[model samples]
Target: MSLSHALLGLLIVEPRSGYELTKAFEADIGRYAWQAGHTSIYPELGKLAEAGLIEVTHEGARGSRTYAATDAGRDELRTWLLRRPQQSKVRNEDVLRMFLISALEPADAITMLRGIAQHTAAGAAELRQIRELNGPATQRGPAGFGLLAAEFGLRQFDAIHGWAQWAIEQLEATADGSQDGAAARSVG
Candidate 1:
């Protein structure tokens, strides 16, 4: 999804200062969906205002401007959300790394896989804590919807952790087979 789309969606839920939105993205939305830096966000906000998609609703200290989506922005956001996306996707870094992992030495790959398993397990555990802290979602608003996304992320972590461990097992079995062959050759 486009950065503009994310900004509009966040604003639709509630008006927020640029600083607030930045923090929101840092902790929540950016983690689950799109990501943007403050530099990009400020400029995007300006562009949205110029396009009449958003407007400054409040002025805070240090020239911070709070933005809210206009009706046009809401319509645009809805249209974009409803539109079916093409099959193409932005490649994930982890997936790219996994694809390239075959280039690594077998031992190194095993080490990397172990790291992946550990990292994902930690992430999943953290998300579980968040889920417990959140209790349950009662509505489909930001808090509730965000919790849904967090759950999806938690599942993804679990799946990746399982896959990494399986890959390590496959590599270890290959090593074991190679060692047995080496010993057989020495005996012969």
Candidate 2:
């Protein structure tokens, strides 16, 4: 989800102010996936402007500038979409931290499991809300693809919740067994 490429795609659709592009990103793509902050987006736009991939026009409306993709930008975008993109490396800090927690006491691990369960539940709730907001009506006709993606997100969230519950139960059982074994050893 490179901000530069996304900005190019948006410009391809039509000329837009930076504010409008940000709004569209947050509402559509950023809602489900790919987060782009103003820092990244603005800088990318500047670079694109410098490269002549996009041009800016000032209409003297509160001194705001609008941007549109140039022919070079369109060609670049086409090349980008058609070419094979490098696979991005996934770095899940939470998952990595959880793996490291094996060094902690069993109780601490169980506590982490509880936190994960809570997070997953919250994510599921958010996904449900997104699905409700973007119902079948939103998907009808031209928006059908977006609607399908929203449904996929909902399903993914549900799966996450289910897996989280199962994981928590398993971790709790393991922690209990470990504690029981420790007690038996002390008694022996």
Candidate 3:
């Protein structure tokens, strides 16, 4: 997720200090997507301000700088939202590790499968929470892209969980030599 675009979208709605933006981002979008930290946010804000995409006003006493999107910024943000985003490469470490598990003993592979199952179960729970929070907002016909995303997350987690279980069975079978109808293989 692009923190700059997310921040700009919020600022376009209303002027807010950095603290308020962080809190709102965490409360709303951050549940589904990763959020930016102070180190990244402040630098992005400075760059945006320099480029005249956002205007900053300093408030007294609190010493907080409130930012609002400029006309140009709004235009830019609109254009960005309308444009198709580039597809990112998918890099799943779990799948890669599983592909290389033949290097390890079957017992070790089973252990890894168990761990993956636990992780996938936890991920499914998180996605369920996201779905509940989003509620009807995700089911509003064509505008329910967020709902589609949440559903996708749910399915992906489910698949991962199923794959993990299958892997465990396969590893156990290999370890016991059940598939070949022979004596159990001892791990040396």
Top-scoring candidate (lDDT): 1
For 1-188, candidate 1 gives per-residue lDDT tens digits of: 89999999889988999888899889778876778889999999999999999999888788988899999999999999999997686777988999999999999999999999999999999989989988675656666657777788899999999889878877876778775654454457
| Candidate 1: residue 89 Cα off by (Å) | 6.7
Relative to the true structure, candidate 1 reaches a TM of 0.83
Q: What are the runs in model 1 whose C-alpha is more than 4 Å off?
A: 60-63, 87-90, 178-188
TM-score quality measure for candidate 3:
0.67
Please state every model's RMSD to the true fold in angstroms. Answer: 5.7, 6.5, 6.3
Q: lDDT (CA) for every model shown?
A: 0.87, 0.74, 0.76
Candidate 3 weakest lDDT stretch, 10 residues: 179-188
Residue-level error in angstroms, candidate 1, position 63: 4.1
Where does model 3 exceed 4 Å of error?
9-15, 24-32, 57-61, 70-92, 139-149, 178-188
Q: On residues 42-158, what C-alpha lDDT tens digit does candidate 3 reach at each position? A: 788888899899999766457789999999899889999899877788677867897798898878878887888898899889878877866754354323435666777778889
TM-score of each: 0.83, 0.67, 0.67
lDDT per residue (tens digit) for residues 46-139 in model 2: 9999999999965547866799999999999999889986778878886688669778786777777677668767776776676676667354
CA lDDT, candidate 2, residue 134 = 62
